[model samples]
Target: MWYRISSSTVIWVANREIPINSTSGVLKLTTSGTLNIFRNTSDLTPIWSSNASFSVQNPVAELRENGNFVIREENDDNPVSFFWQSFDHPTDTLFSGMKLGKNFVTGQEWYLSCWKNSDDPAQGEYTYRLDPTGYPHNVIMKGQNLTFQTGAWNGVRFSGRPKSSGNTMYTHKVVINKEEVYYMFEQINSSVSRLMINQSGKGQRWTWLQQAQKWSILYEVPSDNCDNYNICGAYGDCNINNGPVCGCLEKFVPIDVDAWTKGDWGSGCTRKKPLDCQKGDGFRKYSHIKEPDTLSTWIDERINLKECKKSCLRNCSCMAYASLNISKGETGCLQWFGDLKDIREVSEGGADLFIRVAFSDSDREKNKATFIISLSVVGGVCLLGLPLAFCIWKIIKKKSKLKRSKGILQGSPKGILRGSSKEHSNMSQKEDPDLPYFSLTTLLHATNNFANSNKIGQGGFGPVFKGILEDGQQVAVKCLSETSTQGTNEFMNEVKFIAKLQHRNLVRLLGYCTDEENKMLIYEYMPNKSLDWHIFNEFRNKLLDWPKRFHIIDGIARGLLYLHQDSRLRIVHRDLKASNILLDVKMDAKISDFGTARSFRENETTASTNQLAGTFGYMPPEYALDGILSVKSDVFSFGVLALETVCGKRNREFIHSDHLQHLSGHAWRLHREGRTLELVHQNISQESDYALEMIRTIHIALLCVQQSREERPDMATVVLMLGSNGELPMPSQPGFFTEGNIVGSDADDNTLLEGR
Candidate 1:
């Protein structure tokens, strides 16, 4: 039988299948506390009954405001412990506060099944609920076949939905606890809105407008053909605005071109060349794109943006990555390790997606350097004749001057020693008089009059500039800034230290210029600048892959080893940080800036100074607090730098929750907790042994930063630790333990030493 509720609406019933049938279907309470619904006429059989497993003196049944029929004892006031309710056995519509997901632990599912037809209330073809498998997300299935899906829930919002802003009518959340993974939405105004899964297999939001006395459509999903489940296929982007509306990404073509031309894009696209597991595949970043489907992929929420790229880059199977929620300033990362599907293009609110491409495409895009160099060589040959006459004239003048000076000082070895011996009694007896000296004018011209634009960077004693010599070779000229507090003492220190040192890892001091009010030291230009540049910038840091970073770490270790042991003069670099480690174009690491370097006497083991000088956070506890200096001080700074490189965060400003302090301190705590792997940056490939090596590096760093100077490792041991997998001693608590103050406050507020 079917009862008409309205002209277009009917409540269907099978005579015997559903025993309950009547307009006045009355369910009465008995003294035994059981309520039974009976037919109004004697010939009518009893319909449905509420046989609640509870006893009470009196019971009552009533219809609720939300259309739920319930029975409860007369004296019982706690509504939560309902005896029987129609909501537990729901019909078609899912109201607010109703769960629509599985409880895996309990084997219970609260899902919505579409009605069979417009007039029938039977179960139909579609079912919608949350899927808890593989990074839980909401999914819709049409009779056991997956049709539509909402991407995984990031910390802030659903990955599939464009982040919402400026509206507060409804608040939605997806919760995943130990017990269950479910999705729910709550309305700001109780009487305002409702969500429904209609018979057409559509999920929609409607707002009740009291003024209009009708439901106003707020939003609806599956908005168009592009929104259809996996309509564009794998690695294909669907855009309604495009002429074809569906096409593969760059470097990719349709798997079935004929099907694609016929507007049947379900076949998707494929890469022209298959990825070689060992090589020949790289990622290309596509900005402002909807990420492809990630059904069976692993995701690391804690990984930073750089690590996300590296993680995908290292694995040949990994295809792409995007910010889990783009609006959160790209905090979380999602990686697709297999085939990607259901990608689309939106005019706004899409994330940047990086797609893997064959190596050939990467080579073509990266060939600009060769082309530019070729043109430069060709141009240089053409201009060779133009400057030949001028070069000859200058060379002749220089030679003439040199000849005149040579005769005047041909045998004046004693005179040269006399002038130099007066300045330094400890000078080597065999000094070379031919050491080159640049005129002040020549230095000034090379640096473009010391314009700020030419200045590449600044250090403790001065500003370094990018300079081009008359011969067209680039040089880095370190000029003492007039306002520097170190003055001529520090300048002379750098010249004296660097002039005597010759090592591959040490920076080369090409020459120096001395004139009234001008003192400058020139070195070969480091085109890649400093290690800090790449290690600090989020996007640029991605360029420093694990192998490159590992190489840099080893290079720094070897340089320090040479300074402390192999060099004729034992030197201590008082200040060592990422800023001091320079990189050449090939990414080879070079140590630079010796303004504060000190040389120890042959037998002296340590030195003391009343003045403290070095960058904060990288300073050794003893050197920063007391007036002591030693090779151990440099070791401490090196340890801090190592941790910073691995963690990709500054030690001084590292923050983690409410309990961890600086990066060093937090890393130590994690080490103690047996969770040091948590310290590794997410982008690092686990397949590589970087995690195990980084943990070892962290322990070694901690050993170097120990509170007691004697407890720290020397440069030799540090080098060995970095180069080999030797057994290491467990480190004690590092210096400056402040895990109690995880949320770092102003260091100045405390009576700590101000300078290091």
Candidate 2:
């Protein structure tokens, strides 16, 4: 019969027909290796039996650390041939080293079922098991109905669980081998803790306190109502900060407004404008967002952040994506193809989500029209009284001519070449008679009639061609483009400004030929071509290692330092960039293409203009927005070029999330997060110890590009910072936060606001 250990506690006996009803009822193993129970003085009964499957002479049962009771064969030391084991028939508690999924091949299902109650040990309604359906994920069930889930396991953690830190009490591991899949955890130090699936279908951890001889609650899964099954319904983010604690994304609105207002948000939300692939649809990046569920349809584990966007954009079905594993250099990509469900805005450390939007050309045209109208208004206000200004300009021109003629008369040469006679006659009347003039025919023949193959490169001024004179001297001939937007006045301005300047870093103007349609400037031919060709080209980028790259960066800085401070005229190369840096055969960098160059008096700091012109990405925010040009304009462009050199990527083509439009802003974010190393190009050698120094250079480049002209560092200080080993000042936040477009503003007001 069954024995009642206490009047309130009941214990079961396998062979209950025979009862041992004495105080000396002892169940003991005899020397014959047989276990028997003796009740009274002469009464004996067989309470239990063991038929050890092993042929070994001896066997014994022991409780393992995993809490499994197994009888092992002494000689074979094999527990597989156990006569009896608690694992094959489990009790109420499923401890650390337990298996909980089905053994499909063996037809043996291992699961954790809750007890009827604390006082009863019968099976309960709730059960937990690992589901191997579309993907392997954990599921809890109550009476065959899905109750809770632990989401799919990413490489690092469960997808549903928020990333956790500062939990050092235990180490956890989830293993899936050929035989079974299980969840387990080990204590960091010797502490008594147990995890249990309670009677009410809740999972919890409890730790024992030896002094109090009691158990203390540690943690519980499925912590809140949002954690309940689809509580906010689909495509709805749960936020504890909000009143109702649930809402749709920016471009989305509630599908059932009445239900949502009544606090019944189960129907969730829908898109305001349905995505149409035919239109110019694009993704809007949502940062610090908990990615949605139901990702099995669109997840790709191999692409990078850029590639992930491309993959999503290419396939119209993909709605969003987040990093599957964000810890170790973004190992995997998780994308959502259709509907996004259970999204949340976390306080910190969440992935970015891109949502699709309708694309319409009319919207673009309207934006362009608005920009032109605004520019026209600003330009008109700045250029009022134009005819009166022209009269003043003519009077100045007359006085300038008189002074030039006086200088020409004082410096006329004795000899003039034969072909240059009548043209030379015109030169004698000109103001600057000592100005060297080369014949158009001579320059044309010297440059092989400006052959296409001989053309080295082109700038705003024109195409530069390689040539060899009769004396076997190599030179580059820059022929002004006939169809160029720049006029003769701008060309003459450059010739006049750069002709008198002489520096090793500046491209020397050998001579100029202006006869009829042929206008060309000749200079010493640089064999290595422009710096952009080598530094930015994918195949050639590797040639510039850290040492060579740093050397180039330093050389360019020095050249700029000379232009801004050391030179007699405080000149600014408004278009300073990699394309403007010409490299000699030895790769010595020389600044070229001074078409957009400007000069200032010694005491002057900046100049204002209504015209806005420069390459798109290289233009500083202040100069691009408000037509205020200054030395800082050149500084901003240099910053972009410097970053491009380090990463071997173009600023315009850099692909961060939709929130971050350019490389400078992306680099700034990573730098502030103390993860600037992630910005280094993958091809850069890791063995080098200059990574930190490279980051410093990148920081300085960012400082130079600060949106406010006043915020940018001066050239003198930039040169010193680059050359010195001293500690650098912290840089301010860069331009372009996660807001609307920052374009279409004027330079003066923009610079002033940014400085404030």
Candidate 3:
């Protein structure tokens, strides 16, 4: 029985099939060393017994502190000396230090079985156990049917549950060897926790809360609807965040399109181009996701990832392969055969799976061959001495076409900025001399027709894809979404604004694409993705040290400075948040996404609009409420971003244990108490050299986020404060510090406010 002292919780039962209805019962150990429980007053029949094979000289039945009832020799103190234990045959709950797996030598299996119902203690339909088939992994079965899996162990934790390794209450571990394969968890402190497969077949982690004096659920497997086995069917990936949870992999299409459209993804998907094993096949890498189910799979502990790919390629039956050990640098090989099943996209700490696909001709290689032929033709042209006048005319014609294409977006009234065509032309000629216009066909070839695998991120505008151009240059393609509320206005606005403004801290827009219905903007890709991916993430935040965080803050400030003061136009970035701030290869930050931005003449200071557009947590009080937009609006957002960078928390999502205030309010409270240093994240060391700089940065950020627009410093002044160690004024109260003050309380990022 599990310990509660008041009422013991029944953890396991040996004789679930037989019910002992009589009140008269006797539990005793006989001379044969068998522990038996008799139900009748006559003690004629024993209901249950621990049938020991051998008799001990001095037998003892002792209940260990971990709730493992054992039978062993009285003289033996070692745990190995025990002949039988309750932990070996767990019914529904698994306590700390209990092994959940198999012993090959004895052919004994340890598994958890759910109760028939809340009231009854009989064996239920669901059984949770280690499936040691291809690779050892935990799975739940509904009788004989495999219903759910915890994914294979990936050196740290289960591959499916990416956040499992971050739990502080217990340390989860798996042991795999020739003799046995098991999974267990050990308590980190005095906290009591248990794992149980309940009547509903959900595996839940229950922890005893001392303050509440009750057991509360800490975590659960099959947590989301996506965790159900094969929920997306074969060759499909489940993403709970998306509108339609089930989607096919790249180079694949739904087998039954009509059924799939009606939300019936059970038919799954099939390859668009059938694999030709005779010609050979290649693998397409899908990252940041749970590897497919490993039921029909093989594992080679000795082989590396390269060898695994080669091995899968040689065998036409092998559909996918993944590295077994993700914590370490690519160790062991795992190959899956037949249809790949039960794959899902995880937010963090996920392994990469390479799915086999037909080896198609690459456009880059073709472009290289064409380049060589063009070089040969140019040599012939030089030798022939073409007419100078004809060459000039050809160059002028090309220039005219380029200008015509540039003006194609100007026809949309909503998209055009407050400038004449001559003004735009002059700006384009002066700044963007190398802006190339990519054809729809070229982009289609580059991004595999907007494959899901190529998609890097999704915004209010549309999905952004990573593509490699013909010259092997990688670019980020932002294609306008058909369903997006933001129409041609925002898309053309970004193209026009960024094309004329060039800076090291700004994300460079390479070109634009217009193919009838399709409109896209091509940009230089940032490999590190966005700042939020690192600064706000539990695992990734550790990679950003105080110095790297400071560097990002500095870079963002400089980018803002360019927009506000140094640029050709006095531009105000209406939408500036952590996600819009992208990080490059060296982790240097570059400001992006200028969809809602507006430009002002030298005399203009502020503008008003009936329509409001910006993220919730970052929006300034005046702009969000009254629709008054100015350079200070972005300054307020910068302050929030700076604070988030230092604290490693989201402004809106942050919760303090001591108070009900949001992140900014908590920081303000700490600053008032002269405990500002406590606001830093645990990852940042207090004794680091940049500790003072961090506090100073927080102080500056506070000044920027002041409630009064006049109190907040401009972007130019904010940049100076970041770089210099100077005296700073006390910050006034920050706007929307309390939950009550937040507009449209339920509003999230990219929220719209209807103006009064």
For TM-score, the strongest prediction is 3
Candidate-wise lDDT, in order: 0.68, 0.64, 0.79
* lDDT leaderboard ranking: 3, 1, 2
RMSD values for the candidates in order, in angstroms, are 25.5, 26.3, 15.8
The 10 consecutive residues of candidate 1 with the worst lDDT sum are 412-421
Candidate 2 residue-wise lDDT, 1-756, digit = tens = 111222332222222335444466665544334445556445565554443333435656566655566655556555465555656544334445555566656666666666666544566787766665434556667888776666555555555555555656665656665666656566666565556666667665666556534444454444434445555777787753354568877767899999999988889888777777755466776765555554354556667777886777677877766565555776566667667766665433456666665543223445777999999976875687678667877998897566433322112211110112235335532744445677655665676666665766766665677777787567888766644556556666667667767786788778776554345677877755677776666655654556456657777887888888888878888777777788653355788777668898998887777765566567776676666788888888888888888888777667776455578888788888898777777767462457767888888998887767788898888877886667877777655533334543221110112321
| TM-score to true structure, per model | 0.44, 0.42, 0.53
Clashes of each: 5, 5, 0
lDDT of 3 by residue, 491-520 (tens): 668877998899978999999775544567
Error of 3 at 413 (Å): 15
lDDT of candidate model 2 versus the reference: 0.64
Question: Compared with the true structure, what per-residue lDDT tens digits does model 1 show for residues 6-117?
Answer: 2332222212234443475554666665655566645344565555677766666665555445677767778655676655554445555556677768786777666676
